[model samples]
Target: MPGVAERLTIDHVGQRGDGVSLTNGASLFVPYTLAHEIVETERDDEHPERRRLLQIDTASPERIDPFCTYFTRCGGCAIQHWQPDPYQAWKRQIVIDTLAQAKITCPVDPIVDAHGAGRRRVTLHARRGSDGGLRVGFAASASHAIIAIDACPILDPALDGALDAARALAEVLKPVSKPLDIQVTAASNGLDIDVRGTGPLPTAIITALSRIAEAHKLARLTRHGELVLMRVPPVVTMGSAQVTLPPGSFLQATAAGEETLAALVLQLCKGAKNIADLFCGIGPFALRLATKSKVTALDSDGGAITSLQQAIKDTKGLKPIKAEMRDLFRRPLVPQELRDFDAVVFDPPRQGAQAQVERLAASKIPVVVAVSCNVQTFARDAKILIDGGYKLESVTPVDQFRHTPHIELVARFKR
Candidate 1:
């Protein structure tokens, strides 16, 4: 059931970039709104706390015409309405606040800017249009409705033709009734595509997909992590070494972001003779850290370890890097296992590395570099390490995903 239209003055910006309004006693969240701006909204009964922003009764100084034409509708970006300088400050403050909540304090470096157009990789949703034509683009905000886009300003120039490429691929991938999730990355040579949401691949579909890969010059094509076709091995340069990126392997959204994270890791872990790189995806830090220190890279995924080992073997002029497949969460490297490494560098996913950090806190490692995508989880882990006598040195905030509230940080710790 739809609620009646109402008006409310947005009191503040919430963590997710939605504006908050104190309507009577309850809080209302309006998307694309700003602090202290009066906006018209309709309270959503399904989500009592959320309000759909109908129109701005009064605009804000921080509000600007979003750069992307698909601004509010497309789920790709959030906070595009914010001006750059203020946006940067606010995002940095988020890290500050998160650490403060955990009773930890340290110098936080200014937010690093996202380079060029937003991202090199984008996953477009493909569906059969109402007229039975291939519709390829992003899903709407909080919706499964596909928005067929002509252009996406936020994507890399190399991927400007991605929509058409996905559409062409979808044509070959006929009989896919449900929407296809196509993850396309603009690699060094050509597009790296990993398609999902399709049923099991038979011989006939695989043959056609091979032809599609050839026509589009796709560097590689994969389905459900299984290789369908590969014109050439997809390569990603991690520092000096070019690691063959296993299909669906995690890569940083931007090249500059990877360099920033790697540079910081190299700087902080400077003098240590041995370092453990945990959750090391394709040697983003291991390959680089091996330049100065002996690095042992470990990940749960064997393919990632294999790729890193292969790169180290094929590349020249790098110190020794040992790769291993180990699940750190289930059986974290104990203090005894980590005793050999003087310094530790761990970059975990959004959930952060609680299990690994617990062991790192107990270890006598002189230096630890924690790279995380979630500030709250990072703060939690930081507290664990600090409680174990590690001192929080400094945190560098990297804004790889521009115009979005998502934040990444590289924090250095020492006794």
Candidate 2:
């Protein structure tokens, strides 16, 4: 049994942004407890984990009821208890803290909130439960526990329905001869569903699902209204150019987000005749910038490079943009390779671009746009750039993932 800690008065939230207080001078982290709250905590003696709040003796006025039914159990979102305004502010602070850690000081501009924001392109997960039902949802906070969800408020309506359909299918499918994982995307056609497992989906299952999808008018395995049997289809037009996106490929989840990012990249590349785009997935920025300047797009994914090459071939008005497959972790872009480019743009994963920061400093590109999802890593990398003698220009926070702690930022740097 856990020990009962004396009631503690909550002072404020900690780095995790959860309300924090002290019990007998030992630190305690409590979720859903706001500033100036008094709470009784249950301390876990078995482990080094923080004590849990058992009950709130006093609650803050800012606390509100979460809109989602699964707020407590579903790990898709954090900070649901915070009001919208404060939540946004906290996210901004996170970006600031990240930049500070990197030893870079820049004026963070007003956050750009995403409109119609819940359109997620893909979600993947394993089956769950004793019945082995498909548990298609985000992993629990800091744990592997799968949170089975019927609907995700943050996902596009079309994609949410697909999740439901997948759940329904899981109910009827045979219990556990194999594992099941799924991916759904909103393509130009409608919605596309990719069901993957150890073996090919039985013909009967596919036929049955197809019928169900048609009857329900659900989008399945199609792009921009075109029927595609394979999950990964060949090239489509990016401004009259053939560009292919492979299955499991990384593309901007939202069409609007992609457009917004493209515009920003082009704007930043102004007056630059040469550019380098690192981790350039599917040439979202590289292809777009091609109209203005010669761009070299680098990514580790070979399949993506194939698609990018195809896109360049199909587009008539595109400026010369070349794609290469290189593992950044093993071999980062060096000064020699970067000397030709007047500017550089990088979009790294949530882990941030720490591995390549040194090389970026060495290149000293006159202009750099560092796009990031993780604020902490972004700040860390920003510090490196500052140390490398780059001046921080501006920090723009884009609400790519609304109603969640996740944020996207574009930090401009100049030498």
Candidate 3:
């Protein structure tokens, strides 16, 4: 049985998107509650500083019925109750506050909302139920419990029936009733799926999977880095180039989000003839930049680099683009190598690129556009650039992951 706890009034939303309240001068973080809301909460059994919301006594005016039936039960979304305008403003404020902590202040542009047709990719957890059947869906918030979803509104309509797809595959691939992670990506041809957490498939399983692929007309099926079959190539269009995605390719969740990020990047690096795109995966920005300038794209992933090279060859009208495999974290282009480029664009992973930024700081590159999804790391990197005599030009917040606390941004720095 759950224990009874004190009633708490939520004061504000914390940095991690949790509702914060003070009890006897100690702070408690509660999930699924909003600022100025009254709720009954108890100490979380798993976390010391956390409180589990038991009842909402007073709700915020911003609250609304979530579009998805599985809002709080699923861990994907954080603040779906917020109205769109307030949500956008809050996202921009989060960026501003994060940058302020690093003492870098610049104009923050209005956020670009790209919650388009819906997310093109999703990874669901599949496990065997007690009844020996399969359970397929997202995990519950901060728990291992999987919440089976019949329909997910945030998914692209093309992926609306993905749970059924996952279940069908689980039924066929359940060799020993183990849990699996089904990663599905919607592509130009059809669904590109990757199944993980399973052992080597026997010949019979492969034959059955091939039959499933044929029946569903799947674009491609991959099992833990091994290719099972490809009914058709999984291709994605970025600008004029059509990229044949390598299995487990990193793609923006929605097409509009990619376009928005690319448009902002192009606008920031305008008039630059020579540009180096560091950590460019399959040329989301470099391929588009090639239309006007000489571009050199580099990434740690050989597959991403090879895909970019092939796309450059396939596209007819793009300017010269050179793709190479280089790890920015390990061997970031030093100052001498960076001196050749008029400007540089880098979109690193959420950890940010401190090593690469340190090198850029020592260089004389006239313009630099830094794309990032994490603000804390982005702020640290921005400080490095600013201390190197770079002017903080503009910060544009991009709402690529809608309803989630996650934020993407493009920062322009010029020296």
Candidate 4:
């Protein structure tokens, strides 16, 4: 099947940015192709329904040369060759189509490009090659094989030395050679490095890593978020507040993306005296909303809640923020608890907030803002909210992880 080549015409782009061609009553997914393009492809050995693009017989007029050398090799980006105009439209249409499929109607706004300064963080995988050599970079497309890279174009300029730092750390840990995932975050002070997948390290190895951190001028080094060493606390500015990030803390991919999503949230929740920030991570929305309204920040992450509480103590001239560590999935705020807040905001993980939304739907909270990264799940949750008598007003898509299928959206719901 791998060697058998076939010609196909791409009909359209699928949700994952792959070109789809109907064949023999089945769909064939081909990557790195555009709609209405003729291409020669071969059936992939790993995936039966997928084809590997071998040659482009006819290219689309919208196609452009990809900027990155690792365009097709690295799995990080999906579509970098398409023109911006069509690409943005395709992204916005994704939201519209997804919403329509769920039978929910709302005004979907134009996509906002929030990839201002590129991604501020990256996770590099490190594995030992068969020859006992270390490979540090992203995994190859559709495979577990690592594509060793010296630098990545999509990363922010602040993470200039992230690859080198990961490689250097991998070199030190090469003896055990257990696969390593090094997450590097560019913060206000310096790079915050977190190493995972290593069960444990001896003191000698820990000392070596500490020296490497010093040599790299990293703000801190952590093993699975347990601090190995902290030369300085890694701080991230969230609106007016300064938040010291815990190791492996969740952060919006781009600084501009956070601001963009927060702006939309604030615009919809304006004039509310009380606000509830659900799944509030490091107070990105909570801290900003506190400037104009009393904020109650809820999250399951104790580290995040503690950090938010600490930030409130250090900042000035802001409304009171009550930070609580509660798992919304297990115990979402019910209608009784939701009655006090004039506005409620929930930014859940990819699974969306079905359980939480069920409770929020039962409440009469005047203004509700939903932020999500997964469109399909968001649509399902929106349907639930609409069923509970809330009106879906506006949905604005945010593109922070450019060239990837992933997108974020902020929506407003009113009674």
The alpha-carbon RMSD values of the candidates against the true structure, listed in the order shown, are 1.6, 4.0, 1.3, 0.7
Ranking by lDDT: 4, 3, 1, 2
Report the C-alpha lDDT of model 3 over 1-415, residue by residue, as the tens digit: 2486768999888767788897789889998788899998887778888888888999999877778889889988887777788778888999999988888889999999988888999999997767876778998888888888787888888775567778888889777567899999998878999899888778998888888877777889899868988988899999999999988889999888999999999999999999999999999999999999999999999988988899999999999999999988999999999988999999999999999999999999999999998999999999999999999899999987898889999989999
Candidate 1, 284-392: lDDT as tens digits = 9999888888989899998898988899999898888889999999989999998898999999889989999999999998999999999999999999999999999
Residue range 163-209, candidate 2, lDDT tens digits: 76566545434443555566677655455565665354466665665
- Could you give candidate 4's per-residue lDDT for residues 1-415 as a string of tens digits? 5698899999998889999998888999999999999999998977989999999999999999999999899999999999999999999999999999999888999999999889999999999888878899999999998999977888889898888889889999987669999999999889999999888889899999999999999999999989888999999998888999988999999989999999999999999999999999889999999999999999999999999999999999899999999999999999999999999999999999999999999999998999999999999999999999999999999999999889999999999
Better candidate number, 1 or 4, judged by TM-score? 4
List where candidate 3 sits over 4 angstroms from the true fold.
none
Q: Rate the local accuracy (lDDT) of all candidates.
A: 0.87, 0.72, 0.89, 0.94
Stretch of 10 with least lDDT, candidate 3: 157-166
- Say which candidate scores most in TM-score: 4
User: Any idea what lDDT model 1 has?
Assistant: 0.87
Sorted by TM-score (best first), the order is 4, 3, 1, 2
Between prediction 2 and prediction 4, which has the larger TM-score? Answer: 4
What is the model-wide C-alpha lDDT for candidate 3?
0.89
Better of 1 and 4 by lDDT: 4
